[model samples]
Target chain A: MDENNLIKMELTVNGEAVSMIVKGGRRLLDFLRDDLHLTGTKEGCGEGECGSCTVHLDGQSVLACLTPMERAIGCSVLTIEGVGSPTNLHPVQAALLDEGGVQCGMCTPGMVMSALDLLERNPDPTIEEIIEGISGNLCRCTGYKKIIYGIQQAAQELQAASPAGTVKESVE
Target chain B: MLYRKYEVAQTLPEALSLLSSHNGAVVRPVAGGTDLILQLHERILSADVLVDISRVPELRGIRLENGQLVIGAATTYTEISRSDLVLKNAFVLAEASKKIGAVQIQNMATLGGNIGNASPAADAIPGLYALQADVVVCGPNAERRIPITEFHQGYRKIDLNPGELIKEIRFAIPAEGTGTAFYKYALRKSQAISVVDAAVCVQLSDGVIKHATVALGAVAPTIIRSPAAESVLIGEPPSEDLFDRAAEAACQDARPIDDIRGSAAFRKYLVGVCTSHAVRSACERAA
Candidate 1:
């Protein structure tokens, strides 16, 4: 590694403050997977076409593959690992499990991230809106019907969980 | 990892200084990183130093200044699409912003990046041409404003000097009797590059077209104004027949080439279709 080419970045990932020296041009996806050892975020297409690299940056969904580490400085990033665990899954994750949304599992994390962002912006989205919300994510398995159902179920669960009717932040 | 150094500029002067003082090293200003990062990763473009201007305070936000919509170059597409001022003042731009790629791309892509990428098929550019937008570019010496038409030289080419960076984009707010609309023909409703796109702004006085502009994308080397179509509608009354004639004239101005996304003949045909539809919609809104 060339020390002169290294950049020091400070950012909040999954609610933890991280300060480290990384390659100036290192992508956020590489930082998450290799440096932080958070492998939940998947990279389907290195280009921006596939949404497999979706993650939350400052509460908005963005493609990690296209986002450089320098861009993440002083920003808050949320990953799939931060959203939930096996013991207690996020409502979207649990709903997908119950609704049979996961098949190949490659698109699940990005699907969940985009879904959460959709619901955050629009608490009650129609079927067409759900499709538009996840339009960036390409899922070859399950034909998307089951995934749509899972998102609907997740919206219902989320609405029920928050009786106050406030926008639910995806991560605490 | 194509760049050897990344430096975030907190202000516009710092960005300009960094860009100019690179000492012959290839330097590029990165905002949004949706396009430049991809090109860098694919080895299509390389830079010795990258200046991050995305966070520069002077290069973010959208505001109304002296009856013109001033949008900082770093403002994201998502911000433009959702802005109340943009929706009310320049709805065609907002509409164009909404249809670029999808939600994720919208969140990261910026209008300046669209211009900087200089893609003939850029979805947001046709609207700028129709609206007669201007780009403000800042350099180490001074800032200059260039009209949208002159800003783009050719496919993947813009009029930016080596030490200059785009500062903001601004356009006069359309009058109350004016209407504008944008139409894009892509393979899909989302995430597909445009095969052909058109944007029209019509000003009507007592139900007669007083002024009009027609712009098309992906059918030429750069987003082009259809003077033939504009002349056809400038003094005519709004009607389906007249719009069709104007569209036919617009078709004559297209210089499209056969590509994977579309063919020259099809693109020329769609120019008429898109222009006619966009003109009709704009006239309807004007009425």
Candidate 2:
């Protein structure tokens, strides 16, 4: 492996366009955490089995650990850090906190990302739909009961905020 | 590092050239890279050059041509599950694709990667087998087509040559009076590997089974079709007794072995149960 073989990629992360020289084998999870220091996207399994590395790649939820950095080239990436802020929390984030969905906190970021994507697609998802939407995410401590409630609460909150059923843009 | 260099191919020809240029290096064509990335991390597979085909527009789309459903190899499971053409013409494939992993995995995992990986427990293979799909491959010199049934030579072994890539998978639209169904018996409702899965496609005419195809997975070295069971249904009238016999024949066709997923006996039992369920569902759909 020569340094010259490193692939150059340009991507938009958290609404900021940037360029980097990444190794061919670098996983997106590693790139987000190491290069951008977006450590909010936790790595639970380092495999696609656990959804802890979930992120929005061009507005679709994908597992970062399984995604090669090259795939992110010329694409928009939305990680947990970009989803919402501490003071102006996204509805999903606020609902998770209100519902006590953060037990271990290891899977919260990914869960939030998944739930947000779910709400964006199905504004008024039923309980079953919410469970199915976030089925990929694994939470060991909350036993999924609080997580489901969090998504339910977020759906209602978002619907109330925007009667037209549009997710408020969380990007700052 | 599992791979030293990454090259993106904008076209099929560009990808083939890259493969030939790195002829001696361990070059692997990656689409979605859902399985390839994990394999690289686990040291299960190593490559010097990884040719990224995810961006190749030529290798992505779902369309109907001359009544045949043609799907590009790079088409993701999410795309397949959401495609109306697939849902109407090949509903079993859509059902199988929907059950593969979860939303993230469905978004990232490609049908070609699923076939290329050749996991016995892969959900799409059995459905493709039942649909009688054809795999189209291209290399530097020429292109070729292979039947999906003959595509797998053994466990994890495919009929693909070095530098050759699967371009598309095409199958005939099931004719009128035909019904198909796919079933997988996994441990969990989502993101679980199949312990035993079955896909059944049958055509009924004048209350008699005119045609039948039953494919089973996770119980053999490769996705296996139960010709014996299919033979039993060819001329028989649809009945609980007939389905029972076909299910028995399907169980006999399965060569399951004890593994972490299940015991051999348990898998064999599932073959019978799933086969029966699939056949009944297909029959109901057909009626």
Best by lDDT: 1
Question: Stretches of candidate 2 above 4 Å error?
Answer: A1-5, A22-24, A165-172
Candidate 1 CAPRI-style tier: medium
lDDT of 1 by residue, B1-287 (tens): 66888888999999998888878799899999999999999989998888999989899999999999999999999999999998888888898998998899999999899999999999999999999999999888889999989999888889999899999999999988898999999998888999999999999999899999999999999999999999999988999899999999999999999999989999999999899999999998888
Q: Please state the CAPRI-style docking class of candidate 2.
A: medium
Interface RMSDs of the predictions, in order, are 2.1, 1.7
lDDT of 1 by residue, A1-172 (tens): 2666777779999999999986667899999998889999999988998799999999999999999877898999999989988999998999999999999899999999999999989877789999999999989998999999999999988887786748554433
Model 2, residue B257: C-alpha shift (Å): 0.5
Q: Candidate 2 chain A: worst 10 consecutive residues by lDDT?
A: A163-172
DockQ each: 0.67, 0.68
Error of 1 at B89 (Å): 1.2
